[model samples]
Target: MRTEETPLGRKRRARKINRVLAETYPYAVAELDFRNPFELLVATVLSAQTTDVRVNAITPALFAAYPDPLAMSQAAPEALQELIRSTGFFRAKANSLLALSTRIVDEYDGVVPGRLEDLVTLAGVGRKTANVVLGNAFGVPGITVDTHFIRLARRFGWTNETDPVKIEHAVGELFEPSDWTMLSHRVVFHGRRICLARKPACGACPLTTLCPAYGEGETDAAKAAKLLKYELAPGREELLKKMRAGATRAELRTEGYGLQA
Candidate 1:
């Protein structure tokens, strides 16, 4: 059977997906913990192959020691590496942090540059990191196509490109500039929670009805059940538990249950 393409069909599906995602993840935000542009740059650098939680844990000590670009620039490479050791890629990250800090101190007058091009010129700062700092720290609109965002974009038929830059362009075309930062966070959240890489929980995913990949791997009830069973593994269980607790507390407060009990 040939698939029918209609404007109404596409619009309805898109709207439904957006509405469900917005409602389900009303408070979706960047998980990276940073207070300023410099901190964000450092955190993003440290978070290359590491988890944000690990990066966050390391940043407190690192930031406390250095605090700013000048201080970090002057910091010993060994000292910086020791501070960021837990975040993995310590040697490379330390070098990047030191080099980037020196550039900020000498070139940018100790301020993180707001412009995307200028930000990317810093050592170890790619488009994704630059975008994160620009959008979140400097109030600039830029699309961040990290692994999660990239994976989801491809899965959702937002783009077929594997290159991060291409994916960013494709997404920018789909959504407004104002929604760039928040949209990245939302896609990342959805990718991590429901629309996972290996076995997506399409049945429970808020965007499944809108996703073209939905039910692609499910040919039988038993296979679907097996996939769902794998989704409940210990690591997934822990993540879901934490997310559920946070959501439950927010819901309770919104419903005035917090005041009652």
Candidate 2:
């Protein structure tokens, strides 16, 4: 941040950046595939130090065997551990899951609590995990200060706080509480797809004029475009364009749209 920047200046800048991010990634949401609060809680717990894609891959079988708190609470330790083995730290994660599930069943009647206070009391559930569950599952708003969020928060000059709790509170003051959850998604999406840590696609970014760290990454349009990574990948927009032009899935697949590694 420059010496001339005020708290008000930072606040306005933060909101503006989020507006651009919201427009750029309108489809952003929790990447973890889950149907209910219990599933989301379980997925979030397993997501520590791992990618959502990896967690999503294993949840199907894990859920198939133990779909709820009561069932999961009764799962054999080894069986539960094996189900989530791919997410790494399987033993510790299994312990958390078992402990939390048992607590939920015994205390909360097998239902995931919606309030942050209660949610954080469960094993393996911290503020980040609690916020994710509250925002996505219960429609309660919260800021989730994960790694991506933390990195982007500082880059955006939203806050200087290094602590997750402080970062969450600091950034939370910049936008309305209602914007908290979606703002988190948008910031994380931008971090993952554009304002990356090592090689942000600066020239391809929508917020180039607003970003203070504009020249920190690739600046040439062509080079920055190549640096872009997204769920749609480079082929996503092309596929969407062709689809909008009336291309069918089978036809698109034949055209190699879904064949990327």
Candidate 3:
């Protein structure tokens, strides 16, 4: 099939995808549990390859002991590793966190800098982390291109490049700055629940009509069958049923349920 490449065609597809995603996940927001900029910075660093649930579980204890940059700066590397070991990459993550905390304490007066330029200067804080902190904690406009966002952007034909900077620029140019945070959240929600990396259920996906990669579903039959073997938990089933029965996405999130479909 011929793919969409023209500017008008791309814009139309993006607009439709964005509108449906916004409606599908009206309450989309950050899944990481954090109360402040520092906590968010720490959580984002810990969430490198870990699930939000896992990060959330670990942070309560981690933050309770080292509540701020000053406290965390003085934390022993081994002790910090023990606390976040479950998130994987313990040694590297621990060192990064320690260095980040020390820099924040000594340089920024123990405060997470709101500016992207300054935030990216911290250890382990890349463009994605900087954008997350800016958008979520400081209310600044930023487009965070995480794995989900990148996958969905490519799937939807927003950009053909694999480099994140190009993808960020493409998306940033397409959508208004004000929509950056909300758009990122919505795209992430859709990616996690529908536009998954493997065996995306495009038939039921809200953005399938607008997505160029919709027909690429189930390229591997073995993986597709394996996906079917994993069923949602009883609680998750109840939550999906409730959502189908007219519960708002916000209400479901408030009740501690994530979008699974």
Candidate 4:
């Protein structure tokens, strides 16, 4: 457990950490593929306990079959179940998706609601899901307290709380509301790429000096570099090399990695 520091000291550390993360992950955005708000909402709901890669793979066919709330709300249960089978929790997810679409079609006139309250009221939608939809789709600012955010927030000394709501409120107080959405992306990006749950790449972390939990992982450069997530292997290294050479995020995207973890 970390000793509580002065509030002002903690804020300073958090600000520096935020800045470093922004620089490191300039192109951090939602990794899930979506053409619009409705697609994003469904994709996010299916993403529970699964990876973005898997969700992405399934969504193309899923969306093609039922492209809108009206269409999706009427989809056959068995068909929907089989369609999303590989995403895990298929039956529950299908039920939620069907119910969610039905509610949108019935209540919101076939459009995904923009407000956080209304979004959360939809089936399978929670605070985290609502925040993701609001921030990415509707331009509303919100903090998404995912597992990555929870872990990194404590490691960075921003908040000691374990509850997602408490962690969201605590960190929300430190940054501007507009920064909340992107802050989530950067922190999640760092968490996935460097500050992994089991073993972090401490020596290779750009924010090591600012991090309170600095020595928790391998400190040797070679070993630390090897600790990066599998997806970040050759691509992340190449991306970093270009970033050092002053590549814009758009340029990096052209070179392949513009998605968030």
RMSD of each: 6.0, 3.5, 4.0, 3.2
TM-scores for all candidates? 0.81, 0.90, 0.86, 0.90
* Tens digits of lDDT, candidate 2, 176-247: 999999999999888888888888888888998777878889999988888777543575787646744666
What lDDT does each candidate get? Answer: 0.75, 0.87, 0.81, 0.88
* Candidate 3 or 2, higher lDDT: 2
Put down candidate 3 lDDT per residue, 108-222, tens digits, no spaces.
8889998999999999999999999999999998999999999988888888888998899998878889989989988887777666687686555655556678667754534
Best by lDDT: 4
Q: What is the lDDT of residue 28 in candidate 4?
A: 75
| Lowest summed lDDT window (length 10), candidate 1 | 252-261
Superposition error at 12 for model 4 (Å): 1.8
Q: Worst lDDT window (10 residues) for model 2?
A: 252-261
Model 1 Cα shift for residue 80 (angstroms): 0.7
lDDT of 4 by residue, 83-166 (tens): 999999999999999999999999999999999989989989999999999999999999999999999999888988999999
For model 1, name the residue pairs that clash. none
For candidate 3, the lDDT comes to 0.81
For model 1, the superposed segments whose C-alpha errors exceed 4 Å read: 1-16, 217-261
Task: Give candidate 3 regions above 4 Å deviation.
Answer: 1-4, 218-237, 240-261
Q: Between candidates 3 and 4, which one is better according to TM-score?
A: 4
